[model samples]
Target: QIRASVSDKDLDMYEKWNQDYGSWDIIEKKKKRVLIGAASVGIHHAIFSPSGDKVVTMFKDNEIAVWSFETFYCLYKISIDVGIEAFPSDQESIDVDITLPISQSKFQLMQQPLCFSSDGTLLVIVSIVDSSLFVWKWNEQSLHQQIDIPLFKEANGFNTPIKQAKFIGNTKLIGIVSSIGLFIIVDAETGKLVYKMPKTVLFDFVEFSKDGKFLSGVPSEDPKTIKLMNLKDFIKKKLLNYLRNFGEFPEKYRILIWRFLLRLPENRQPFQSLCDKGLHPAFEKINRKYPIKSYQMIKTLERVLSCLGHWSPLFAECDYFPSFVFPFIYAWPILQTFFASHFSSDEWAVLMDHIISEDPSFIYYLTVAYIRYHRETFLNMKTIQEFNKFHEQSIPTNVKMLLKSAKKIQTSTPTEIDIPKDIIEPFKPIPRSPSAYPLFSNYPVKIVHFQKKVRDKIRREELDFLQRKKVLHELSQLHQDIETDERKWIDYDNKVSTMMDEFWDKLIKDENDHQEKVSKINALETEQRTKLLKNIQKVRQNLVHQSDAFLNKQKDWEFKLDTARASLRETKIVGHEELQKLIDEENEILK
Candidate 1:
């Protein structure tokens, strides 16, 4: 379920844009105003710079324009060969989820909009008609969000136009990564294909699951299937259900069963062979002798084990190593399922010992995964020799015993399979060693200060908010006073007009009588006008003084910004000088 929606979809436009807002270029936010240049036909994308100060637009004419709105300036321009359909990459860019269906032939690539990541890390240009896709990377110096047009094939349900775009952080971005009916999810922040998921429409949109475990979409193959997951979720959910027959075993007791199921590779030859042999007829004899109906369990195991046999055929090392590494890298419950079955304490110890000794790489991450995934187990076994032996370079006797058990794990088929020999040669012998490998934290407290600067800006905005409110209040009061003054002047003008009309009407009837009074009235009016002019001048002078005070405050703020830049320059100079001195010392030491 979508938890939130994007705000501010309408880009600010002026004048002629009252109708053709789409024609405006990328709108950039600087302070209060929005800056935009022509985007050829319409503004397909609008992006704020990393600082949210400048904006760049990709135009339909294949021209890129830059704008700084706070200054009301068009700063720079770069030309592109591709048309105006560029994608915006700011973190706040819209996250679209599309499960809607559209015709593949109608999907035009030339008009499909491009996408960039929210943090300004990657740029993407999508073409629905040509079925071409491009991915550009950010590498600091040149080509910030460059595009590499991807070649794609045209087909029916297989290939369709892409319609949406999104980022899964920096390394992996999902959604419509390509045309030809594909919702590509490359590696997180990087361009590595984890799995290709299905989409509903030719332009079906894809997004990351909140937890980042699965990539789900409104399905193409099945309309009702809005959620699709990897083999892992499939198994987990299958185990989760209260089924007709999980073959036997309570839901609570099925964890170890699932773990064992995961350990069984995509292709299970042993299971297939068992189903072919039909449950070891020996189990039937044992059931008759013991009255335990263990044959039923054997049959269930046979079918489950046989299920993997028909899966994709596996080649040698190259094909399967990545598969093996994935489970270990991501600790799928390999041990949990194995132990879920009723097992003796000796058996449990033996399994643990074997995993640590023979599967050192697996064991290292297992213990780490345990600490990560199974917090309780990690806390309880925190001091266990098995987990700590990597640093100690010593294995306990129990570890050796477990290795023996793993080695002895066998099938009824015939030949003894050596676990070490079966595994790839490179991983056959992971040495026991004591070494201090530097540990790297997932999220470093020290970022490059870019994000920190954004936070500081937010804080500054909060501080300025009250100041802005005060300024607004002052302006409102000024506007109300000006309106009141206009009303008083209008009333005074009306009274003078009434008096003049009465005098004009009286003059026609009695010109002689009115001459003396009119002269005296005119003189008095002249004096009153002089006094009113003087008072108006004084009020204007007071307004001017207040205006100067407001302007002075603004100038002071600008000056502070200027001084801050100077201080920044001074700090950089000192740091540079120190670096130079250190270099000189190092040179002398080398001599």
Candidate 2:
């Protein structure tokens, strides 16, 4: 049998009926019960629990009753107070046979006010009047949580009202859609917003899949088109967008973000193997060079450096090797607050790869920017010693500014330079000595001088490119302005013609009584057209003059760019084969 509830014409009486499932025949009719005394009072809506074991009915007067399905008895009753009056005291006991009346309505509802969780153990009620949410442990007849939804100021400077809300599957989370189509998910336990989607379109309806893996909505503008989204992918995209826009991570998530960005595998076995091998023989000079007070810190640094050396001999050959390990050690103490384990050798190796694999042109641009930033001070220095001292002091004081300026220079220019592809070759391990001792006290100075010469050439080329690029951009803008002006003139002429046609039609309709008025209108139209033509002519003349000037400037810049390109092709940085020969000569000298 199937059970159904019905209301009379006046809505003051209610009845429950039992009917045969397939035949549509009423098997039994329960007694008619007077639900409310006032004819204006009525039952608003009713819904069954998922199991159909219980029924919850809301009345027009802000009173709700929960009833048992088997006995048809009223189990509990509660009244919602929307700032009108205090809540009515609960009844100690209620007779199963009797029906009670409720007070008159106090506040209007925006939508269905309440919903049940999947298990029916909890209920969520949206209070439209106060903009609040109340979760109830309905089985226990007690309030579980109350959350006040604040109005966001950025939502068009008004309080976006909640249109509908429901529990997401069986989880302790609630998904809400506002009237303006802003969707948000909130953690029911913590009362914190976990995800929010901006209001880009108005939705007529929204629903989550049973498992809460997907959400589907019908846009109000196009009811036939349904928008379905995978919740997991949507959240990931939102996270990436936030990172791109804000470029900062919260302290708790920093390590995880760094690991993700660096693509760290965190392979434990290989890292452990390197650690077990102890310090490398090449770093035996660390005690003499950078003596430390903390024995544990020194030991940790040695272990980390040895792992790097085994991974790549190039790292062990660098003059300032300790500088790399010092940062990781300092970060280790802070990272310990979030993670229990110490930094691994695998992470260090990955960090080194990123630092060393950058394109050589990036470094050249950085050095060039650094020099130009202190160009005046260098030009003023008379002696080489003075220049060297100034260079050493300026680096420490202006390091941050120099980096910012270098990034600006790199990004602002077009990347069209034609350089040899072999410039970005991978690092090759140097042949080890028989004693496995460190090779040199400092890096080779000749290589540094060679790098400086290449940087100076690249800098001149970049300056020439920038000048040509600026002129080309200006020419493009000028062409667009001319087209825009012509479009505007055409639109103005069409508008004037339309107005004149409408005015002429009106005069024709009232011709007999307005002969003099038609003459005056014609004269006024003629004057307006003449003035418009003069303005159009003046604009055309100005545009023609501007075009002529820009064309000449464009030609000049193109010639300069051609000359720069020719010069770049003629100039030669050492070829790869020559560079290899130089490296071999240096190695033979060391041997």
**For each candidate, what is the lDDT?**
0.44, 0.59
Among the numbered candidates, top lDDT falls to 2
Model 2 over residues 101-209: C-alpha lDDT tens digits? 5566432354556777777777777765556677777666677777777743344545556777877766667888766676778767668776787666567678888
How many pairs of residues in model 1 come into backbone collision? 32
Alpha-carbon lDDT of model 1: 0.44
Worst 10 residues of 2 by lDDT: 17-26
Compared with the true structure, model 2 gives a TM-score of 0.37
In order of appearance, the predictions have TM-scores of 0.31, 0.37
lDDT of 1 by residue, 1-591 (tens): 101112244333332211121212335542233233231233344454544455554443334445553443445443223323323443122122111112233223233354556566655545444444455543231233332224234444344445566655333444554533465554324343434434344334455654344556655446565755553344344433422133233444344444433343323444344356443211223233223235565344334323322221121112222333322222232222333122343444334433422433344333333334334544676556855543233222233333333334422223344343344233322121233112222233345244445655765786699689889999999999999999988998998999889888877758865787899899999999999999999999999999999999999999999999999999999999999999999999999
The window of 10 residues in a row where model 1 has the poorest summed lDDT is: 309-318
Provide the clash count, candidate 2. Answer: 0
- Candidate 2's displacement at residue 341, Å, is 6.4
